[model samples]
Target: MAKPPARLAASPASVTPPLGAKPVPFLAAVGLGLALRFLVPIPAGITVQAWTLLSIFVSTIAGLVLEPLPVGAWAFLSVSTAIATKTLTFPAAFCAFTNDVIWLIVVSFFFARGFEKTGLGQRVATLFVKLFGKSTLGLAYGLSVAEALIAPAMPSTTARAGGIFMPIINSLSLSAGSKPNDPSRKKLGAFLVQSQLQGSVNSSAMFLTAAAQNLLCMKLAAEMGASIVPALCGLLLTPLLMYKLFPPEIKDTPEAPKLADERLVAMGPMSRDERIMLGTMAAAVCLWVAGDMLGISAVTTAMLGLCVLLGSGVLQWRECLAYPAAWDTLFWFAVLVGMSGQLNNLGVITHFASQVGNQLVAANLGWPAVFGLLNVAYYALHYMFASQTAHVGALYSAFLAMMLATGVPPVIAALSLGFMSNLFGSITHFGSGQAAVYYGAGYLTLKEVFSYGALMSVVNLTLWGVVGGAWWKVLGLF
Candidate 1:
């Protein structure tokens, strides 16, 4: 089973929601689904078991949206509900944990936690800035490239952008006479923050371990016998797009090199942990990219790398156990995968797919025509979601099924939906964890962030969808 999409928006400062935010709408959503299960007529070819699972799935999604409980809690309940109703047994409910996808992400999280504890994340960023901070545009791309370099080792964009890039970017903004309330605010601060936000998401999409949700999508694609196309199409174009879209007042940033040099010198040489982290990540990525040819799965290589880190004292076992976000992701992703797998086995997904096919046929839509419409609808759904992972978890699988119904191949559906999951973060400040941190920096007002976010969404989609998609087609991804 593929993993559940993770905390695509786990922020550095984990803010709790208001308790008084009513659960009434959530309850209504679940109740309405329950009514549909009994009142609505099931078409002839569908099984009662499948229809029941669909109702439960709908109610579960409502609970996820309403958040009367945390996302993980809803996942737990959904799996338990399947068991209680004999939709699946306990082993079936728990089987997703045994799958390779779940463990790959689990180990990836441990590797990331090592980066946080060892100060290795900062070292990577500072090194890139020191080498590339010769000009304003160059410095911005430097930061972007730095994020991309370390993205393979870190799963949390919030942790990557918020924990590492946010502070560094803020200081860089101030040093360039671009403080929040000053007249020079527009000079570099806004551009820097926007650059960070856009850069993080695109880089996150480049590698499987770059973002938590990427791994989930990878699993789904692999399960469908589809390739994820480990190509650099997005990376090749995203920086150029940012260079064109986000221009600053100043060009030659002579002061930036001096600032970065001073900071690098003050920090001194890499610590033992940082050295180990750099080496471990380098080896891990090589294996991940070539593992299939070498007869080693990505999960096997990742787990071995993690064991080396732990045994070498770079990351302690207790620290890995205590990492809450990783644990949260494990619980939710595992259960959600189990539930989704069970639903597919029970024919609920097939029935749902057939229904969608009928509707598209009625509308006289061809496969490609329906696909473009669905892509836009999928991207637009990001407005209702605060976390990219949540949006992916709630919609990705079912919608991918619908894409299949359009007579499109699974690989096409998988890549399209997977790419959209990360790009959705570019649409709103609240759309992703990194977006939240960048927006909170005060360089851009809410309206400005949102407006620019919307603009960048179009730019990113065009580059990725048109340019990147053409490249993937060359690789036979479609």
Candidate 2:
């Protein structure tokens, strides 16, 4: 007799949330804006228009945090409200779309897509594993090195860690009998997962082009008369720091190199497309590193590289148009940047900074003490943030303003806050997209995530705060 038809599992809900929006957070955000607009008295030397803009900006930030609607939607609505209320002219509200930094980031996303399409990113990771997978610690370092190498070209941390490296890690773990949710998990899987996540975080901190928000931080810093140079101290120290903090159960993995070797052999050789991508990336990096001295802007360098890809047919125009993340970023990024610039123009940020600085100045603390306290607070505050870009957008400028008002050096204050923007992602599973990806892999327990994340925050703060301070001083950055 034939068996009865089997029952099918239900389909999961769509990844995209519906447009109808959640009510509680929505009401709370709108209420906060209205309360601030009506209840709070305007401070001395601030106009009603500036105060109104501040209320709208605050509401938008709250909406971003509560996420009653998609971030882009919130940004769009905020801009629209600003125009309708006559707080800003249409041209003034849309001016940031012409920003060079915005285009640099958008084009860099296309560069990242080239890395993904041509498989160069995967090849780089596989080669590193094959070269350094003889021991568990060695394997960790290998992955860190690969992440640092590709990070400048790949702006999306999730794409770099989750899409490229995680697959290799999963395969290696299983090959060595370390399956998730089983007795053998601790043997190799958990350690590799944690190590890669930490490594990616540090790599993101090391370069300006490594992450989208780093560019945002750069643009904001420039507005405050500070120039942020990429710092190498974090990248050099992160892997070893993580190893000491979170030691793996399996100390040695004799089969790891062999496994990596098999994968590399199967990948055969670099294709023509990868070669083109590599040359384009190399040219772009060289230009970016020396562009200022060579009279070329970073944006021009990125555009030049992107044009090469398009001209050579390495990436089609159609593919570039289809990249949702790049376009999505361009839209919301321009809106937030324009609004933030207007706030600065209207003197809201400066006024807010001076008021806070006056109180902190009364404490009679040294600049170093003030910076240390502010830095720690800034790092800890990431607990309340889910997106690094949003956190930087909302707080980085204000924090830098306060630091400057208290007599902190421009480069030091700017670079410190910028690096912490990436480092603090290690503090929580939802702190950033990459963190969510690693946590969701199920190799780590909740206790492990929090404990290790907290410890790493301390280590990262000390490393960047003390050692990085000394390094920057030596380089005359201060």
Candidate 3:
């Protein structure tokens, strides 16, 4: 029998309340926000604030469409428009294509492909499931922990957690008697879904090397003349935060005494792929940490890793090209970078930044309060963005400028904003790529995703308030 199309699948906003359920009113609210930006006019010059708001609108429009092209593509288009309009120059338009951060993303794909092709990823996943596979929730923790452990070595959070872990979780949940279409299984499936997404985001955030944007944040910080040491600072606190913020569920407890035997047997043994991946990954990590010591750029180190994998016949040239997301990601990032250059060149960003900065100064705020305020505002802005790289590229400079104008030290302002950029993804499914991946896993409805994400945003903001203050004090940044 031909199947009837699912109502949710057929409609826009399938995972949430139907568009008509709250359509015009919701859109009106968004329109109001956009209108508010124009209420207090700023002088015309390259302004970060103007670009920030425009980026927000673009991101919102893109997320709603869910087109085959990712958010990054739209980002490119926006930048191109800025250039065509004389908002940016030719050199700035193309600079992102050559960015070190962009190269890091490219080379990481080669390494990831080599690892994935080996089928070793499945063995590792299976072994993890065997250890924690007895209960539904145990599987969640196992997958989450495994991703966290591997994130430092694997630059692609989507590849490590979303690509690798998500499939295993889906199959295991099905194997454990959670039927995919069973209405009763919805809640359980949703929980499993959240577990994987949360794990990916949390683990990715823990390591600077975990996501491309995280590395970009480090580079951007360095460009601003701050020494926050990406390798040293943020990761130490990741595991602790993951444990505290990630909740343990009661339903995931095993009904029978769990055994490690069958899963162990089913996994067979590791192959050449496993050993190769492990070696390559280990070598990559060493290079990442020791790159500065070895007098090499991180991009060079990433290229070397790619070369090792390709030259060794571990991953074929065509195979590397076939990995869709890597190139796709690059295109999007390049576009965003171009758009940023345009915003700066056109003088739109500067004008907007001045206006916002003046407003904050007039309010007579201190540094810490300004930090908290900007942090909240940025994350709140994420509700409209589906791409973190695009959002960060488009807005970081303007917001950073605003913070500095408010008497915050440049170093403190830069690093805190960089950290908050990654932290903001927890606000909505459309806030970041990883968040979207979680929603697509078919477990979480839009409402559930938003609820948890919003809650986590509050948690993160509170943590930022306390931890950021101490870190500032420790470093004498204030």
The parts of candidate 2 lying over 4 Å away from their true place are 1-18, 132-256, 365-478
Per-residue lDDT over 254-351 for candidate 2, one digit per residue giving the tens place of the 0 to 100 score: 77568878888898989999999889877876776566568887678779988999999999999999977567667766776677778877877667
Look at candidate 2 and give me any clashing residue pairs. Answer: none
Best candidate, lDDT-wise?
Answer: 2
In candidate 3, what are the lDDT values of residues 1-478, reduced to their tens digit? Answer: 9999766545564456443224453455345445545554544553654554464444434333433233455455445555665545567667768766555656655554554567654455455555775665566666666776776766655444343555455555554455443546655455666656644555655566766676666664443222233312333333334334543233444532334355556657777666766787667667665565677666776677677777777788898777665676566645554444444445554455456557776788887677677767766665544457766776787788788777777777777767777777655655555554455445555455666677666755666566656655766666
| Candidate 1 worst ten-residue window by lDDT | 222-231
Error in Å for residue 252 of model 1 = 14
lDDT by residue (353-433, candidate 1, tens digit) is 546545764686877787776777778766645557666766687777778877777777787788788877767655665
lDDT at residue 337 of model 1 (Cα atoms) = 59
Better of 2 and 3 by lDDT: 2
Q: By lDDT, is 1 or 3 better?
A: 1
Candidate 3 has its poorest 10 consecutive residues by lDDT at: 224-233
The candidate scoring highest on TM-score is: 2
Give the count of colliding residue pairs in each prediction. 0, 0, 14
